[model samples]
Target: MNLKARITRTGAILLGKYVACDGFDEQQPIRVVTHVHADHMLGLRESLKKCEMVLMSEATRDLIDVLKSPLFLMAGNVKTLPYKEPFEYKNEKITFYPADHILGSTQVLVEDQEGERILYTSDFRLPNTPIIRSDILVIEATYGSPRCIRNFEQKAESVLVDLVDRGLCEGPVYLFGYHGKIQEVMEILWKNNIRVPFIVPEKVFHVCKVYEKHNKKLGRYWLARSEYAKELRSKKEPFVAFYHMAARRRFIKEKAYKIFVSGWQFQEPIRQVNEKGFVIAISDHSDFEGLIEYVRKSKPKLVLTDNYRIGHAKILAKEIEKRLGIRAIAVPPTKPKKK
Candidate 1:
């Protein structure tokens, strides 16, 4: 069996005859959307014009709906697939497994007629249950450097609790994070009995509702503009608010105690310290150690790394070859299209 594939730099997209991962193009009729992240959904709306169907997990489909994406408006364009279940697509056996990146993120496993296997992990993190193994492993290297390794989960809740405690005495605690992270933090707070009413942006609230609908039960959270927020603000008492990082500026006037959560907090310098917020190291992707451990567990014959950071994939590939003795290489970005 001859299998040829091309993956983009960030591993946001993969191209092949039977399986197209996370991204879409006119050439590939069957596109697999791994999750609802903006980068992963590239060309989806345009691809629907020509493609037969777009494959994604049900949770992701619901997320697109909550996001009010145009893709949701396209009738019969999206098809939902169950996770960890194998199905035939274009004569190849394909399976989807929980990626543990976000609520509905998944890793694709493909088996050809000859039993040759290929796995594409679009964006993943640790603490995930193992699914199928593969011969050729194409993995994301978002936090792929030795310097990116950090054991934050054990202390993440404590750190946030401490910050919340301190901020309660000062002012409203503003936490800046993405959709999944925000939900996870809220769950953590709830589990710890923090019980503080959380004010969340509209999008974040939508995601929380989806989580609850899926039986995850993120507890209670008020939408940003709801009466709950007005009541909390009018009390002149300290409160907690969760906002997307892009909306950080909206809370500046409130004089809230701000904290930005991300894995790159250590690597990238915080800009405009007086205005921007403090950094809290947190990540959804596997670190250097976790990536190495994943490679060891998968025990793939070939390892391919793709990430947004230049040289990250190459560096990780080198480390894999040195330590694991696997044939590893970094996938270069695809050439730019002509005008």
Candidate 2:
């Protein structure tokens, strides 16, 4: 397939015909933001100024309203589209499919007037992630390396529950991860029937509300500063407190047990960081095998491995070509831009 495929230095995938996904290009009249990740918001301001319309899933738009200022979405040209429902623009069709990444993440499909299809998969995971067929595939390689496999992925949730259960027996338990990740842990604990109340900062508490509003029901949680939470903190009753990944340093391990969430673990899912602390492997992204499986199942004639910002896109593309016999190449990161 000689389809137009390339990523701007700022990590935006450009179809060059109708739209730009995950990044901005002044040349395209349409801009599609796949998720709320900071990297994907590159050139957003410019796109909003230049494009006719900027689009995202409704959940993604709400996430921005919560995590970011809502002023961005109040723009006239910004719009939301339903999943599986296509919106026709000029001579193309665009649609968003739910992604198994964060709360509102999605993969985008663009089909031009010629009936040629292009898919840009923002970060996603497999076994559950939907596979969309297209002539050209643009995929994320956050775990694209051959070594980036999660053998304990299926058991990660169990391990997390066990660790937290054990930690509560001693004292307060502290957990750290990104915004969406923290919310995900809430679901895992709730589904397992762990009813222990969660105490998080005010921001995370708001994030949890958004999750609940979207029908992503999480368990009982309280704001860290609330009178109830403060009383609970003083009592011997053990509870979990969540923090953003950057707060790892602010954590005082001598006071309580800590479980750091990460997906980079290749050998052991649980790694001992200190006597009272450990790192557990749990990621929202598809592993190396999952990435290959996606391409194989989708059967795209050409694969564009996105390495513009992170992941071993070059290695992943090479692996795809060798293992699946599919033509794949990494999009070079050029003229990198800040979020």
Candidate 3:
């Protein structure tokens, strides 16, 4: 009846010996993928190879069908479970909740036979995110620093639209981010009534089609090399081009504006890098305040902040203990917790 939740040195989230989340651990038989982001999919191949079964949301599964090489979804071990449906194993039950981070992102809650619960908030934004209660809470520390709070989060959409509007007035505007994030910006433009044609790379076009299949509406867009896009380019009209950050470069020749969309900036939501360059702090993950707020709402007795990711894990653990009076620790540490 001893159920534990902690991150391993290899960035694996192990719930006892039963489940591994995001990362992979051999001892864990079931692998639960929270999302499709590369960082969260560490040791995914190993997990798929050795683990008994791999679990993810249906959208996450569909996304893998598009993004991965050699057709990843064709495997029999991969399973897609709907949200709020508890799947019972030998002596435990697991459930998925919407993470609000990406298309198929989720927060996992595992309950032992004795009713002890452990919730993993892998990557999520606080807005409209459900707070799942648990005895042991394992959370991401991507924006966990006390000073990492974004005051202008509510204004990110407006700022982005304004930037695009101004950029489009002059020439074609380029928007860059990861898969889900760039699609989010596209939805924002559509919602704000930014009526200009969208041109995206091949993979990006496919990802947007997936979003549409999931009932997420995006404005009219075309593939970069398609005849429609070429026609729009010939017109010399303003168009927005979307590219994943990894593939972004000097592809467009005209005086086009470039905007990098990410959540790393803390100073302002919209940061002007140069005359034609801008950085939008429109993040998918929760900020420091949102992380703390999740902790406060869930009221977990023991909290573990993930130290494996890029942000301030130790600082978040310290802040959690100091501010919420909860027993908090950063995972994969050298020293044992002082009880």
Which one is best on TM-score?
2
TM per model?
0.90, 0.96, 0.95
Point to the candidate with the largest lDDT.
3
Q: Give the TM-score of candidate 1.
A: 0.90
lDDT of 2 by residue, 210-313 (tens): 88988997889999899988898778678889999887887773478899888889898799988879899999899999999999999998999987867889
Error of 3 at 245 (Å): 0.9
Off by over 4 Å in 2: 1-3, 333-339
All candidates in order of TM-score, best leading: 2, 3, 1
Give one digit per residue, the lDDT tens place, for model 3 in 227-266: 9889878887789999999876664444678999988998
Clashes of each: 0, 1, 0
lDDT of each: 0.74, 0.86, 0.88
lDDT value for model 3 = 0.88
Q: What would the C-alpha RMSD of candidate 1 be, to one decimal place?
A: 3.2
- Cα error, residue 178 of model 1, in Å, equals 1.0
Which structure is stronger by TM-score: 1 or 2? 2
